[model samples]
Target: MDTLSFNHTALTAPNRTVEVGGRRLAYRRFGHGPNLVLCVRFRGTMDSWDPLFLDLLARDFTVNVFDYSGLGLSTGKPSYVKTDMAQDVDDLVTALGLGKVAIAGWSIGGIAAQVFAALHPEKVSHVLAIGTMPPGLMVKPSAPLFLQTAFKPENGIEDQYILFFEPDSARSRAAGDASVARIASRSMVVDAITPPAVMIQSVIESADPTTPFPDPDGRYQAFYRSTDIPVLALSGDHDIMFPVENWYAMNDLWPTLFVVTWPDSGHGPQHQYPELSADLIASFVKNNPRPV
Candidate 1:
């Protein structure tokens, strides 16, 4: 296929579907080169990602964005459990016949990415997490304002800035506006809004203090401490939902992990610095090619 024939962009990419594990999943595949499956955050569809970020990533990778089961255009029972969400990634990769693809996730989606990496190591080449917390107890819990604003029936531009970027920082707020505009350019449909009941379930799961992701026996923590899979997590210093400081607390554990934090920023660093983030991703993958 001629690359020029298709735009391979967030707005222009065609929606595709595939049957897996008795249900159909909705997805879009754009860009070129190795496969990169991205998981969306809570209350988010594949459509919510920043356009500039996707376009920049398309330069070196064939980005695959998908809705979890029963979300967006998909058809099946819905779940917000992080491990179950990771299972969606596994099943989709198997159905697509992709080999050793990089798994990227944002916010709660990043939790699923970490789960996928730890449990299904052979299926993943690397893990890219944006605006998310690492597994286990947080060094600092999420701000109450995050839950208050994030679950609103509708989030205005200001809410977006607070939830995803730094409203206090003029530059971050401007970047938020640009990203919101880019996202708004896409055609909107009613099906994209996750149901309220499901959102509630997600909220509950997100707050569960004893999530088995850490596992009582210490296996998952050990994986982070000693896995060969290269991991990269990006965040803004004051992320209301998942603070960057949590990653800092784990400094001694992850030998192969790299955390990038932007000053005076918030949750959505990729949206704020799309081009630089993409460059970092490409460089990370190039420098740490997964064992073939």
Candidate 2:
């Protein structure tokens, strides 16, 4: 589901840019109904989102995808901040004029979602967090050490793609590299080194999530306790970043949550199994409609 294949003439290209935290945010939207905003994992862009999964989701809810400042079509490099990125979520919500919206995030973006929902529970309807941890990982290093190396830019972004994909077999790695490269090349049009740095900063900051806004100690708990919003915690059966154990720990902390696993998938279940992920989201939204 590459963007190139889309008939640009047929669909209206979403309006881009609105001031959010003094940074120009880049966002694209499709379909219409209840708004759905997808926050990318550390260092990801709207184009990096799986096209197949989005096409499936567009069948039901309106989907809005964007990048954090210093990444993708967004602006500001020196001003990039993790807490600011979290605030960008709310700003975009207001910019879009969405009264209430579902917030879904992956990896560090999940932490951003937690902060966003915590601060503005009234604006968020449901949160779908995929492949993320509660706060600290020094206590729970479920991920393999090799996985840490994957995040390092010296190893190259291709290595991270290999780590995130399912089966991750020799064949999978080869295919994923080719696939990731093509997509990244199209969306990341600006300077070569900038996008990677935006991602690195996000990771370095989140390494100590406790220092950031909303505070780490019981932060996830606070979000769960404070918000009436229903959450769907989804992770891959083979997720290496935030392992299945991390998900269990999170679920144990919040009993009301429902957990779903993609048995054949890895860190990126949505990419590996877009249809299934979309179905899970669609079902959750249907069963747990937000109040007006």
Among these predictions, the greatest lDDT belongs to 1
Q: What TM-score quantifies how close candidate 1 is to the native fold?
A: 0.93
**Per-residue accuracy of model 2 over 128-245 as CA lDDT, tens digit each:** 8887655544234545654565556665655655467654466445545654554555442322244455567655654544432235466656667545688888887767677667
Worst 10 residues of 1 by lDDT: 1-10
lDDT of each: 0.84, 0.67
TM-score top scorer: 1
Residue range 43-91, candidate 1, lDDT tens digits: 8888789878998898888888899987888878777777778988988
Which residue pairs in model 2 clash with each other?
none
Off by over 4 Å in 2: 1-15, 77-82, 136-139, 142-147, 152-161, 167-195, 205-216
